[model samples]
Target: MPRRLISSGSTFEREIGYSRAVVDGEWIFVSGTTGFDYGKMTISDDLLEQAEQCFRNIQAALTEAGGNLEDIVRVTYILPDAGDFPKCWPIFRKYLGDVRPAAMMISAGLSDPRMRIEIQVTARRSSGS
Candidate 1:
């Protein structure tokens, strides 16, 4: 199948030469999504709220590619501070539940210091995806 590009209206996606999400065949690869919502660059101070928005952004991208949270096969979470993991993990779990896909967490300074969490996801439309 020809690759399908998903844009978020975020100019950076075009400026940096990448789409918010890329779909190849039945697989969808969502880029590392930041806390910024839509075209807004403002980052929120509340980590929990920021995390929620992150997932929401992923959801919209996945839906555009013929998938949803249930289709997520793996996820990578990058956090500037591991200490905030405890506070935000439960909120992530509430969204992922037992169907939790493969996930990995790493501590690294994000592009923006105000960014507490960033997530990238891969999903597929397999019979079991």
Candidate 2:
């Protein structure tokens, strides 16, 4: 199957020249997604809120790619402050408790200081799904 590109209509994707997610056959690669709501381009100041929004954004990309959270096989989390990570565990469990994809977390800086967390995921569509 031909590769397909998905967009969330975020200006950043256009400005940066990258798709929100790319669907190639059964595999989907979702780009690192921040908390800024694509519709309003606004992000909350709270760390938990940002983490929740990150999952929501990722879910949108995965859904557009013909999959859901359950399809995610891997997840990578990037946080500017490593100390804030423990505070986000509840939010993480809320979204991925059952899916439980292989995951990792890294401390890193983001292009925008407003961004506290960014999530990137890899998912595979089940056959006959």
Candidate 3:
């Protein structure tokens, strides 16, 4: 099996020495992604807006890795404030409510204070689906 790496053209990826996502055989592992718009390198202060952008970033990575949000089998969310998590549920549901992948949430600090949410996901591409 060959491994492939995906980059979002974010300077941080080069500075940090990490790809935005990696594909190993049937599995695609997307790194923890914040709300920053890579094209503009800007992040929103609103938690819900950040959550939406997080999903957008995740989706872009998944697509580049030859999969989509529906392919996600597992997901993890990290947030600095637990209270802010609830405010993002609606946005989360809009993306993963039906797919309903195995999910986990953690209260933790992020690299930047403006980032209220970070998301990581693992996806598996079936042989024939």
Candidate 4:
């Protein structure tokens, strides 16, 4: 199969020259998605809300790339404040506890101060499972 690029219609994607997700063969790689609702381009100040929105954005990209959260093999979480990460656990567990993909969390600076959380994931389509 040929490589495919997926877009979430975020203006930043066009301005930054990157795809929201990329599909190649059986693998799908979703970019680091923030809490911003792309349609409204707004983010929440609460960490839990932001975390939920991040997963929603990632799910949208994964769905467009021909897979779902169950297919995810790895996940990377970026948070500007390390202290805020624990507060997001309940929300994270809601979406990923069952799937339990390999995950890592890092404290880092974000492009936007309002962005409390960003998530990126990689998935592989199962064959005959």
Candidate 5:
């Protein structure tokens, strides 16, 4: 199967020779997407807004792979401050609720200090191999 490159204007992807996501057959791998608009890395301090942007970024990549949020089977959330879980979890659950894709959360440093959260995801397209 020919692999299709996914780009959301993420700086890391352009700087490191990588893609925001890769689509091969039915599988989609979304690189760690930070909380920012496409092509911009610097983010605001609001944890909830940042989380929402991260999810949106992942969704955009998934869509490019001929998939959607409903197709996501797994997700990994990385947060710089775990304490913000309370504020961020609600938004996450609100968006991914019934889909109930497998998820993991880890608190760690981000590439940019201003970024508080990053999300990586996996999805399978219905028509995909």
Candidate 6:
């Protein structure tokens, strides 16, 4: 099967030498995505807002890969502040409550100080989906 690459048109993808997501057959591997609104090249200061944006970015990449949030089988969350993780539960549930994919969170520094959270996901497209 042929592999496919997806891009969000974020400058970071080109500058850092990475695609937003890679599709290998039915599997899609999304890169660690932050809250930046790629169209405006801007990010929010609020953690919740940033968290929401992260999903939006991830959703966009998945859509381009011919999958949706429900296809996500695994997800990884990275945050600069561990304390902020709990604050994002509602937002997470709002997006993935029903799907409830496997998930993990880690505390670590991000490339940009402005970035509070980063989300990466792995999705598999169901046959005929």
In terms of TM-score, the best-performing candidate is 6
Output the better candidate (3/6) by lDDT: 6
lDDT of each: 0.87, 0.93, 0.90, 0.91, 0.84, 0.95
Cα distance off (Å), candidate 2, residue 39:
0.5
Off by over 4 Å in 4: none
Clash pairs of candidate 2?
A: none
TM-score, every prediction: 0.92, 0.97, 0.96, 0.96, 0.91, 0.97
Q: Which ten residues in a row are the worst by lDDT in model 5? A: 38-47
RMSD per prediction, one decimal?
1.7, 0.9, 1.1, 1.2, 1.9, 0.8
Question: Where is model 6 more than 4 Å wrong at Cα?
Answer: none
What lDDT score goes with residue 44 in model 3?
A: 83
Name every residue pair that clashes in candidate 4. Answer: none
Q: Backbone clashes per model, in order?
A: 0, 0, 0, 0, 0, 0
What value does the lDDT take at residue 62 in candidate 1?
89
Query: What does the lDDT read for residue 66 in candidate 3?
Result: 85
Q: How many clashing residue pairs, candidate 4?
A: 0
**Pick by lDDT: which candidate is best?**
6
In angstroms, the error of model 1 at 68 is 0.5
lDDT of 1 by residue, 1-129 (tens): 999999888767877899999999999999998777775767789998889989989998988888888898899889998888889888789878776899999889997778889999999876654
Error of 1 at 107 (Å): 0.5
Name the 10 consecutive residues with the lowest summed lDDT in model 1.
Answer: 34-43
Which regions in candidate 2 have their CA more than 4 angstroms from the true location? Answer: none
Q: For residues 37-64, what per-residue lDDT tens digits would candidate 3 score against the true structure?
A: 9989998888888888888988899888
TM-score order of candidates, best first?
6, 2, 4, 3, 1, 5
lDDT of 3: 0.90
Candidate 1 achieves a global lDDT of: 0.87
User: Weakest 10 consecutive residues, lDDT, candidate 4?
Assistant: 120-129
